[model samples]
Target: MFFLIWLVLFLVVVSFLLLLPASWHRAIYERYSGGRPVACPENQQPAVVSIDVRHAAVAVMDGRPNLRLSDCTRWPERSKCNQECLSQAIQAEPYKPGEVKAGRKQIYHLPVLLAAFAAWYVGAIWHSHYMFREQWLQAVGLTHAQVKQIVWWLSPHLLTAGVCLLFAYGVAWLLAVSHRKGVLQGVLMSVLLCGALIATTWFGIARLPHDLFLIEAGYIALASLTVGALVGGLYDRLVLPSQ
Candidate 1:
């Protein structure tokens, strides 16, 4: 059941990262709604051109924002001409929201690994006897002996570490795709992903005890923030500069 819940949360995080940015990019690109003026490459004639913003936004996730002409003033007559004018349109507005630059596409492994370890450590502490372990055990109605009795090829801690690692990777991927850097950007993205996890938790409110829900939700929130800050901020200030 726990693994199932984690799997669902992972899917939710991925969906949020992918869909949100595409929607945002589409909105930002709406500035080109009426079309922009560009010089036709073939005849050097001035013409109005419309861009396929939706495709561009979706393409941004793949590290390149595709620029294609949906309609042009020279269309029907010269529509088949290569979109050499795309260069001019790009020059007019060089930056697009969520557009990942070639240099920023490389994923820094150190920060992601560190963030995962940190998140897993935080989870360990959160559920330790020194902290809320007693309350959590009570909330879940599980005794330490009962927990020890469970048999599996992988220990629960190992599974948690694995999940944390995957989650950090997901966060890093989103940051890379969006061309976002700095601690603030990392924290913001992490918080958004954490919110998605919390939403899934909320759906089980009726099936779970209130205390258990609170404990699980709180831990997830803290772990997410830790992962985000480390991957986002640490990578920008420390690891990225060294690379």
Candidate 2:
């Protein structure tokens, strides 16, 4: 019964994700498509700007839609001017020189990279000889000798590192898009994302032993929390301020 319920919820979530992009694309195109008159931030002169609606629509999946001018009346010669008029065009606000508009938040690369390394390190410790190394080997039906024979690049460690990096970037993207800062918010977002992962783990329940499933899920939860705290709390409070 639990599995059936989970399956239904999973389908609903998947359908929502698949449909959201298309809905966003249509809405964005309807609202921002075609040429619109915008006051240029450089000289405060009136200019007709054409936005790349298709590009902005596609970028909606990344949490923030990137607005770029496909063509401007002052193009070819004055094209080198920064496209600050985009904000004015969308918000219907007068261009203010030197004033930063509230738009896409910058993703901090250092924090994201550190978060990925931390997650990878947690996995390394979790699977080491002092931890579940023997049990994991047994669960996978692989002997120590067979495990040692696998090439370094072909091993799970490299895959884990890659996955951790991607997950960290995803967390950063979520934080940036949602304008969520601090450790608590990070943990909350990470927990929600991890819940999705745990739900998918149900599919492998029949194939994996209970111990193995627990071992993997436990590591994922721990790593996710660590990343959330580091990126959300530490980075936001310490690193972001210093920058």
Candidate 3:
């Protein structure tokens, strides 16, 4: 499995998600006997319409108003997000009519996404190291054992990428949903949110052993944000009849 393979898989997953009918997310959660549309609370629904809402939310809430420099380097013993930010989060978009409103918009689905990212990381890291090992071996390479060690070394980027995904979508929703922001605004918000995520994690995270891995993560953040933002803005622009 090469990085290209992993990247293709990532794109494929997203593409399949797109084909499943625009309302598939709501349908997946609806799972009720009644076929009638259900009303979701503002929180239970996606704050925005994009496919990547989960990522936006995590990126938005990655830090506190007063978190210390030290905390950035250390992973908290447990997850805690209640009132993590001083400012009131912009409200999520209104639930579609007839949808029951949940108390809070699920702006981000953290646990589910973490699981997904971890899976991707393992796959990508395995692919990257396997290739590295093969080249290293053919050239004058290291042992299989050494290859495994290299895999372990690159693990931090995987974890950091996952962390960055945490809040990326929540941010998109904050602007596009709660604030009813225009496409450009939503895209800009998402870009800034992602930029903040890369900066905070790269600077604050402890034990990032590989500098190239760090560079790759930074580049990935930029790439992912650009993709996410352009997708959103373009989607919005295409909606106009004039366009």
Candidate 4:
């Protein structure tokens, strides 16, 4: 029953995540565009717009449009068009939003390995004694002996380490593909991935008790957030510069 629930959940989450790239692109596009035009200011020449392509901000070069001396001369003083304004426009940097740079594929192995261990440690502590051990086991209707037997078969250290390592790799790859870097970015990405990957399964299956799902899902979310931060920081500091 446990395996069946997990398998179904995995399939569903994978499907959802596969569709995430298109949604992510749209989000980035909207962010850059400000999703709307700004109201034009009074007594000013039409603004010149440009894409920054690095910081992802749209810059409106105010009081300046591509102009020739003939264009400004015709407008005169009343039009707010003058030689000074034209010179200012010439000197001003274009307000163009930066393009979305792709994330680098390189992984700094040491940091990711350390992060994976940290994730496993957090999960162990959180599940074993810190938060949800007794309540979860009881909710799942598993006895102490059965729990021990399962742990023995799965091998706690190996299972935790292996899964966390895989998760770290996936998170790093996602960050690269999404062209995002930084601890905060990582945390957000991890939350989205965890929600789609783990929470979806728990909610959709409905076979597990609510408490059990909550306990397990909460731990997964926490672990993903912390691990993402660590990996993101490492990638920015170590890997990003090289690329």
Q: Which candidate comes out best when scored by lDDT? A: 2
Model 4 lDDT-worst window of ten: 68-77
* lDDT by residue for model 2 (94-141), tens: 334343333335577778888899999999899888999899998888
Model 1 clash pairs are: none
* CA deviation > 4 Å runs, candidate 4: 1-103, 154-157, 199-204, 238-243
TM-scores of the candidates are: 0.54, 0.55, 0.30, 0.52
Evaluate model 1: give its lDDT.
0.75
Sort by TM-score, best first: what order? 2, 1, 4, 3
Write down the lDDT that model 3 would get. Answer: 0.42
The predictions' CA RMSDs to the true structure, in order, are: 20.2, 17.1, 22.1, 21.1
Tens digit of per-residue lDDT, candidate 1, span 92-131: 6433444332233446778999999999999878988899
**In order, how many clashes per candidate?**
0, 0, 28, 11
Better of 2 and 4 by TM-score: 2
**For candidate 3, what is the TM-score?**
0.30
Candidate 4 C-alpha lDDT tens digits along 83-163: 444444334443344533211345566657877988998887887845788998888888888877877675667877998
Off by over 4 Å in 3: 1-165, 176-187, 198-214, 226-243
Q: lDDT per prediction?
A: 0.75, 0.76, 0.42, 0.61
Query: CA shift at 203, candidate 2, in angstroms?
Result: 1.7
Mind sharing the TM-score for model 2? 0.55
